[model samples]
Target: MEQLCDCDYEYDSEDQYTMPEFHQKYKDKLPLLVVVSGGFNGKTVYDEVSTNQVIWFHRVCQQSRVLGRLSNQAVRQYEEFVSIPVHSGHMFNVITSSRNESDPETLEDILTKHKLPVLVRLASEAYDYTLRTVKRYTILLLKTYTETFLQGNCLQDDILLPPPLLLAVSPDISVAIATGYVNKSKDTFHRKLRQISEFVKRNVELKEKEGCKEITLFDKQDSTTGTGNSIPPDLLPSYDEDFMYQDIEPDINWIPPIPPNPGFRPSLPARPPDGLLCQNDTPVDSEMESEKLSHKQSSDVSAGTFNSLTVYDDDESGYNSSAGSVKSYISDMSVEDIQSLLGALNLTKYKKDFRKHLIDGAMLEGLEETILREDFKFKHVEVIRLMKYIREGHMPKQ
Candidate 1:
């Protein structure tokens, strides 16, 4: 019979029920209440302790932290309440029962929509929302909401949340309204949390003043801005604003500078040794040897410096019988040519006047280079004729 029933039983003589017998029947049942009354009084009954209401709110806050600690300390508790249970426990029942007492519908909505695939998505989204809202509320309550709730503010843990949440929330406040934690919008949940918080503070004050036996809640002005988390001002003398506050919000600072022009080319000075050789002195005599050597060296050095220039090396055969070449070349040359040629040699404005000097140098170098080259051919005849042309302003007989 025992094998057929799949039951094992033990008997207790005095109690009329055996330990194993009673356990087999009732072990799976949820405890009707565990710490239900004290937890409820702390959270709900004393929630409105007038100005002294923070006592109850503080207890509720402590309870919330306790809930978190309880939730985390025993995964069984969180799993069972947040979802269906893998295993059963009496302690989990206590937490869930009280946890649902404050807001039944919201809890119901979560539970009603609960399914495996849907719950996984909800769990992920919930984690994200929880991370964001917790950071915001904590910032407001601890950093900005200057209150003497605790003597030293033991719970004011400096929460350094990630920037991604701040970045994500930034756009939501402008479009959604203040639904901090509960609703999908920006205004509703966040505003409500702060409203409750401030309300609790006021009630705490009234309770302390009135010496009330019961918790008494009161109305409070909405202290929080939809954007800013109702943080307190910075103490610095320079109009110190809150950390969340900014002079220019949503504007990305520190952009890159403009790039330089790629095609631009700045010119350099046309190098020295730009003068022409005189039209007079021709070689054949030993006396002109020194002049020939100096002129040759000068031409070579000039060539070394300039990237490009015209050279005149074989022009010793020009007829100079009519005039002096230097004087004649200067005078016969148009005044416009003189100014354009000479004025271009100015050292300043190196880039602009650069090409002009090269052209002038080209003419002069060509003249000297020509003389040096053709001195053998022209002898005194060609040189003398060219010199005369320069002195008197006429071309020598070719």
Candidate 2:
């Protein structure tokens, strides 16, 4: 017989027992600095910042699967910099967090003062037979161009120097020629990149020559600032004679295209000479008794499983109305679902008619929301909405 103890005991496996967290510095949230560069260095900065942010930001922000791969050093650095407040049971309680700008240990104070989000972009290339080292170096130059541009709050065509150009046409390029990695493949990477720079410069120069003088951050050819574009039309240089790509097109008749397979063609279903689907029996017709029964049984099983999941007993009070409502709302809140919904909305006439009007109106005013102990603090509107809910019916206002 098994012995019974006076006191009750429970055994929790190591996997089941989560480590008791001492303190968290802050509630996790996603940071919103759109970093875009042609190389890995810029990616590194993004990774670093995200790593520092995840512990506090994950709770409040929509962290994606891609952000999960950040290294431990980055996480540790963030935790160290953002000290948790001394609190009962909880460490990084936002309620007790110091908001003083003078706080020596805060992350914001350091980053703002130091100007430390280092933007770096590297280079890369891909190929098997043909030499294409230029791809890698072009990426590197792209990084340099981005950094220089970011020095100002924004950038326009404004004669972008290191834009892509061709080697033969551009003279201003400093071609510190280098061979490709792995195989010292025959290539003109540095020269090609320099050419790209020159090409961009010429485009900008053409724009400047045009009547349009102003530029914006996103002032590409199609979307220039002035009524007319700042960018001038690209004039293709003629060689010895004017020639179209069609004129130099290579002719090939490597293999005569085989006639469409008569047996397995799209118009007909394939069949073996014996006409049996398997070794067991002959092919069954659509209205065959056995086949119909099998299909019906399968459909019934599937419907039963779906009904089991979706249909809940109304009499059971296991889940309250509020809980069910919250669950339903959250179920629809996924990014993919929102994206699909937006796509559908965009296809409607209503979108074309009322989009601008909607943007300008207050009908879209959202609920004031606030991040609680573990929730995110998105904006003032959200904060107000949340406050209303939390305060609702709790007290009588005098």
**Candidate No. with top TM-score:** 2
lDDT values of the candidates? 0.24, 0.21
**Candidate 2 stretches greater than 4 Å from native:** 1-67, 70-319, 338-377, 384-398
Top candidate when judged by lDDT against the true structure: 1
Which regions of candidate 1 fall more than 4 Å away from where they truly are? 1-222, 225-267, 271-398
TM-score for model 1? 0.12
TM-score of each: 0.12, 0.14
lDDT of 2 by residue, 140-247 (tens): 000000000011011122222333111110111111101221222325434433544455445432211111111112223332211111112221112233221112
In model 1, what lDDT does residue 30 have?
A: 16
